[model samples]
Target: MRLLITGGAGFIGANFVHSSVRVHPEDSLTVLDAMTYAGSRESLAAVENDIRLVQGDITDAELANKLVAESDAVVHFAAETHVDNALADPEPFLRANVIGTFTVLEAVRAHGVRLHHVSTDEVYGDLELGNARRFTESTPYNPSSPYSSTKAASDMLVRAWVRSYGVRATISNCSNNYGPYQHVEKFIPRQITNVLTGRRPKLYGSGTNVRDWIHVDDHNSAVRRILADGQIGRTYLIGAEEERDNLSVMRAILRLMDRDPDDFDHVADRAGHDLRYAIDPSALYDELGWAPKHTDFEDGLRATIDWYRDNETWWGPLKDATEAKYEGRGQ
Candidate 1:
């Protein structure tokens, strides 16, 4: 089997590629990434030569069509992922997340390749009432920000292709992911690297925002399953159910690094930030026979922190840029 993964040089996507290649040696992988600032080659250093790496924007229909034509399956992960990045200027988000997705859908329709649309739980906005039923496959999308609106739009487009062209498709909306090869601009690694080198972790507002986090490996496993046996047009919610507030998650990371809790900075809240994004993966568990293998947040945090600590050179240059930019990419 040959798979084409967009945004393969980015954090979760790169980890997925590494994990997939290690597990399925017989399967060939092709990664198409634009190599944006957030999409670093360092994450994919080990597999650059092993897997074909095509550097091009997904909005280019010609490139997208060519890549899809060469693969057995297409995993759509290319998008301007940050909420602030999207809010700052939504044009790029629309072009990449929405139009870029359409480009992929058209290519797959022409090439007869299966598609797994990698989506996010943020598409279902804040649920301020009633037990907060985990956002399931049936949850109606209520996107609260530009980032999520584009993703929701793309998700709708994928469904359109499934109905209009009889294309095989599966959508997985995963929770916030935290693991190795992440840029320092993200919350977890930003905090860990900041305190480790005597910088303050800058957090937004009250830090009360809630999110469920999953290990990248666990997410990769779910994607593999969706590719293997998921029914066409099925939407799977992939998460570890390890829900934690932003403040709590940061403190937990501090505990892992044996650092003082005071080594942090709090600021005004971001515009249009959702209070919580929780999802129920019971449907995927019931139907796909898949459950999270690493549900322990503490153990996952330990391993993630150790990965950054051991590989300083990989994420070292990113620390100053993270602080100078006053930007972060997680809950």
Candidate 2:
């Protein structure tokens, strides 16, 4: 099959490309990436020969239509994903996440191509810290940040397109993803790179906020399954059932890096920060027989740390600028 993957140079999308190339040799891919600050060409270096990379925006209607017209399927992954950036300036997120998704949907509808929309669990907002409830497919939309709100809007667009235009599309709202090639600005990579650079990990507020963590490989695997067998107009929640608080994650990273667990600083928490986010992937498992391979968070974190350690040349150049951005915000 020929696939067009938007934001293919970014973390999760790059991992998806790598996985597809390795597992499905018969498939061909064309990656459309804006090459924003978070999206790096180096992330796709290993699979460069296997896939065609197009430096473009997903919001470009003509480009999206042309690409979708020629592809068997489209995986929409392009977005301004950082919550901090969204809080500071939401215009980019609005353009990339909402307008970009509209463009892709229109193209897919016009071309009659299958599409898989990648989204986040944050769109469901936060649950009570100790609540037994997890985000299910029926969870109501309650986005707290501009980033998540835009994603929510995009998801709605996909649904409306499916019902109104009969567009073949599936949506997957996944938990936090951590693996190699992730930008240093993200939570896990920021802490990991901080320890590597001889800086203490920074926690926000009291570090009680929790997040459901999933490995990027597992997330991509589920996405592939959805693309292959998932029902159109359906939504799946992809998670590993591994829930951990911010402080615990920080301490674990420090311990894995052979540092003191308490060697961290408490910075101001993010505005409108959700208390917790947990995903119930029972439907994904019972319906599609999908399960996460990396269930052990520590093992995954260790592997992720090793990747960052061994590939300093890849993440080193971005560390300084990333830290500076955070420092400037007093975060």
Pick by lDDT: which candidate is best? 2
RMSD, candidate 1, Å:
2.0
Clashes of 1: 0
Give a tens-digit lDDT track for model 1, residues 78-128: 888888768778998999899999999999999989999999999999866
The lDDT of each candidate is 0.87, 0.95
Candidate 2: Cα lDDT at 56: 94
Q: Tell how far residue 197 is off in model 1, in angstroms.
A: 2.4
- Per-residue C-alpha lDDT of model 2 across residues 279-308, encoded as one tens digit per residue: 999999999999999989999999999999
Candidate 1 Cα outliers beyond 4 Å, as residue runs: 327-331
Measured by TM-score, the strongest candidate is 2
212: Cα error in model 1, Å? 0.7
- List residue ranges in candidate 2 displaced over 4 A: none
Residue pairs clashing in model 1 are: none
